[model samples]
Target: MENNSPRQRQRRRRPKADVAPAPRRAAPVTGRLRPLSQEDMARISEASFDILHDIGLSDASPEAVRAVVGRGGQETEDGRLLFPRSLVEEALAGLRRDFTLCARDPSQDIEMTRSRVHTGSGGASPMVVDLETGAYLPAMLADLYDAARLVDTLDNVQFFSRSMIAGDMETLRDLDINTAYAALAGTSKHVMTSCSQAEHVRDIAGMCFLLAGSAEAFRARPFLSLNINHAVPPLRFDPEACNVLLAGAELGLPVMVNTFGQMGASSPVTIAGCLAQTNAETLAGMVLAWIVNPEVTAIYGARPMVTDLRSGGMAGGSGEQAILTAAATQMAQFYNLPNSTIAGATDSKIADAQAGYEKALSVTMAVQAGANLVTQAAGTQAGLMATSFEAYVIDNDMLGAILGAASPIPVDAQTLAVDVIAQTVRGEGHFLGHPDTYARMKSDFVYPAHADRQAPDAWLANGAPTINSAARQAAQETLANHFPSHIPAEIDRDIRSRFDIKLPRERMRQA
Candidate 1:
């Protein structure tokens, strides 16, 4: 009964044993795109140093002035704080080049170092698109909590920053406290939030101490950081924000000193001039942070924004914006400091074709250029003026693909599969049924949960759902069901008793 024919033998041959795919874990992807050359970098560095020595930044806080002056900084005749080239270079040399942003859950910690990219949600959008009615509504504390929960479930969104402002809060103090509480209670991921006052920073640190059970414990593993916009463009320091930065630095909280320079508006019209100014501003922040705590984890947040010359508004979704942010990343690399930049802030009011292309181009460029932290990488819309729950779900899919492209491609003897290819050529003429195919299926490919890839017939059978509709449905399902309870109930009660936590506990649970 043995046919002994070549076809029969091939059919009877057994495939190799199936190997399990590696576990899915979020690791940093190294960027490869270089938007600036060596000469450009040297010229910009020199210009920035010149700006620092000559023009100096005005309106430095008393504390910042004291710290910098004690460390060899000078004051201009007009009261501007002048950082000599020597002081700046020494500060840069002493800066912490790498550090970890710890999370409540240890698994979510982000390692910040050279050119390792991580994307997350960021913005202070005042409005959020209503999930049920699709209307722009003033963002509330509940919306921020819900956004954090949504980001917690998204694999590609690495961290959760406060994406929207709690417009309903009566006071800035309440907004800052509740924002931190909501972000922490919603997810165990590392949180970054802005504080309105120095005292609020201490209060939040107190809350963090309670959560971690001790001040030492909280310091050992700080789960939250301060995103201080320390610089106001046109070469000035924000005095209030600088005070907050000093407080955060004293408490040993990791801080991101963001310098947002809008071209043709706050900064010089020319790109080179804009870069030099922003670089000078960011370096000023670093020097201040260094004077406070030489060991503090400070990130150079150089966010160079583009302006539409005719309309005189932010063109966040433009190609110019993409290259500008990418070039900022290069400037950070030039200093050998941990850095962040903004991308994915689309001008489109909604998640549409325009939003897709704009977000993709900018985020891809930032990631490729090796920005350590890519803020506003998801859920932003209308030029960072609003955020949408549906966009969070949709952008999650897009970020995964972008990160996948940034991931390394492996080449080896097993992967080359010369023997397998030869066997296939002599036998089945295909490798579809091979064990390697099954083993590499999940690891090698990233499948989108919302993007439609079905054939026309199958797509029609499924009612031809648009990405927005699918994303909306997915967002609804998540909001309705996914309520995170990482913080223990007893600890939460203690926090509520001590601080004026505004977000209702019931809203954090399923309805």
Candidate 2:
């Protein structure tokens, strides 16, 4: 029994000042870099609709063909689905704009209201950069779980997508089950992962249901969502990917319909042509989702990838890649849909000079363009083929600064501080010891935890740590501790009994 007496209640009550909301702090402000005008957007939209109504898509699933034909669409001689302009428009109009991405803990939920931009980690890399030797090694299941734990503690890296592939799992069944388990156990934040087969979706959903306590409770607030690469670009549905998308719809889970096309190869060489093709393919995917379940929540995925004309490989870190991705975010807003896209996936193998500029340029551009979820923002290198633990921590600091730069700063009467300035100049002769300066330190400034900001003498005296070393130290410290235990012991026992979970429970404990 608990005490509910008046004295006990009064003692628990916090003072008003402590409980009350703090003063409105100023956020760093910025605008879109060379954003498209309204007329430019209209032109792109018209071109996209024209492509869907004219060129059409090929080799859709039998379910998709039936659904399209039933919904006033036509099938080609070779079995392609020709979506009329009206069908695409209807799907666009029916999309749900506002929804909540629930986490294991209620407080970690992300509201997709599109109020401000949020950056996080995302990738499916096969290799991991060793924290001790800075060498690339095959990523294992343990690395994925450790990445989740590191992401959980990083303040700026808000959500954790499946950043690395568990190369140790020999079977897809074990991989899927343990991947979901590692993510759920490592972090309470929202976790997004993809599946190779439709049945895996149900299995993962069952796991989520168990975590939520029941099927009905899981449906009410499903914490897990699926990232479905619903279509192969140049207008064709990937058979397996489409099945996964439909499965996600059947479970009422949020689906991210990502359409990836390499410009100048799968799509046209011109930026406008690429956007039009991608937009049309994306709309076709939305139609498929609506046909499966009319009320499914879809995330508009815009992967505006570029190809290096010289070598014909992906130019993920190029300036053109950043520009195209930023502009594609504008297209997502045209249909009033929540959007996610790739950024900060550098082509560099190491977290050196090349990596810094490449990641920062793309990420900053995406934040300024107001993307809802910026994927590949952390722990990605070598054109998304590898992840670095040190770079993950460094990228968290970079994302914090990027977000701070994008934040809106309030410049009003109170912020002017004319009185404070005069008082400082007259009495102290400088603002260093001023009361206002001390009060505004936290409110006005955004500081990087891993970045060194000391003078030459102090820096030399402290052994002059580089960014890479500093991030490595932080990553080691975080992985040594910070094991979250939200899932109960009984639930863990039941999950282990039912599924083929490979991650050892004892390994989750700190040494």
Candidate 3:
């Protein structure tokens, strides 16, 4: 006989109608609804498996190999590590088939591939020198804010850099806090800034905490994440960074392991040779992530550049970079993973004629190539050096233009704005004031103020600043005008307390 206490008796009385309704899933965006072809899947799977099995690892830190030691990983005399063939099969078998990286703000979320091309500027090469002051500095909190603010205000800019904006961070060691703060200040969507310190993964992990309020927050709405490179040799994982990747894996934050492919240097000069190298390096990292946590989400990417054999300078904005970018993205897809790589970058500064040509070529190719994630969007000049606010403005306009070029013709009844176009053609209709025009123009047409369709004399009267000057002023105004979305006072205080930093008086809330 069961004893029914009063509490148990009361629990049985609850009615089904009083329960909360299940949440509804909104319709997936059109691009998200598209499916991959069998050939598409084959190219991705075959190339990805080849990378996992036959390719050689480069500069895989000492500890990385050791992580697989007893499990059939072998070590060389000089400390290079090698994994047996079985590891490749095991790694690929467990990868999650398909899943959305849910957005923190559900309204902002989109599929891995989307109609709108998301892009941003980045400067994570780990060295910055301020020419104005002739000072060498380390990454700091201010730089993170500058990066975040840069991302916040621009409708076209979609990501932030991971370097100090105004300082020389050549010698800075405490990057964990600096990286963490940048992501926190940036928009509450996709952001990549995890600590390089293993134990301090918690510090970066805390930002992910606020983004969704739980580790489970990552399973659906991943926000803050990390990127780790398999150092040029398959030797070992840097203890600090490895720990962070492990933590991110444990927590389910996404990571993109990008290898810097230096053709004729670290990689073979042949495109095929270089792809094999970069792909192997990326796959090794992906396997490591799975080893750390089965639930970890990872992407494959490379910023591989050809080295001019004589000059040794990286030809990042060169034509070959696009081929490499496209090919590698294909390989990542073979593994059924998302990718991130550089685009819209140039070695030229000042938005000159050369700048326009190089940026357009590089960015356009990557877009048409169908890379999932692309950045190096703005202000990447002199090989991603010497910050120019104007350069960012120019890049913003260019990205908007590039995205416009990528738009497929809308075939739906709404876009057929055929009736509206006809009315305007007959000279009896004012399209500008039309409701249909108002509804569609902003979303479909990206008009540029730089476009001077005026008479030569009228253009001269307007002072005719070059794209450079217009961009410069735009960058300055952007920096001045942007502000973080207002966080609640309690949340702001908690964020500040975590860092032990005080807010400036102007930004502080009234007592």
Model 3, residue 474: what's the lDDT?
50
Across 1-511, the per-residue lDDT of candidate 2 in tens digits comes to 0223232233224222111222322222333654778888899999988888877888787777787889999988876789998988888888788787788877667666563466778888989887777789888888898899888887777788888889989888888878889988999888888888888988888888889998778777878778888778888888778888888888888888898999999999999999999988888888888877888878888787999999998899999999999889889877768888899989999998899999999999988987888889998999999988899989987887888788776788778888877787788688888777788787766678778899989999999989898888777767766678989999999999989888887667754
Per-residue CA lDDT of model 1 for 1-511, tens digit only, reads: 1123232233224232232323445565675888789899899999999999989999998888898888888887788998989999998999988788888989888889788888999999999987666779788887888899889888888899889998878898898899999999988898999998999999889889989999889888889999999999999999999999989988888899999999999999888899999999999998888888888889899998999999999999999999999889999998888999999999999899999999999999999999989999999999998989999999998998998888877899998999999988999898888888888788888888889999999999999999999888777767666778889899999999988988877667654
Superior by TM-score: candidate 2 or candidate 3: 2
lDDT per residue for candidate 3 within 1-511, as digits (tens), equals: 0213232233234332222212222222122211345575455455545544444343444455556665676665654456555886687778654545443455545356432245666665333332223233343444455456555555555555453342323322345554555445645445666455565666666655764566666566776557666445322334455555666677667776767768888777877667666666666677777787777777666667777788998776787776666666656655566667787667774567777778888777666656656767666666766444456667777777776676566688667767778878897557777777687666667766443467888878989757665554454444444555645557656766775432242422111
- Winning model by lDDT: 1
Candidate 2: segments with Cα more than 4 A from true spot: 1-31
Alpha-carbon runs more than 4 Å astray in model 1 = 1-23
Clash pairs detected, candidate 2: 28-407
Instruction: Assess each prediction's global lDDT (C-alpha) against the native.
Output: 0.88, 0.82, 0.58
- The full ranking of all candidates by TM-score, starting with the best, is 1, 2, 3
- In model 2, the worst 10-residue window by lDDT is 14-23
Which is the winner by lDDT between candidate 2 and candidate 3? 2
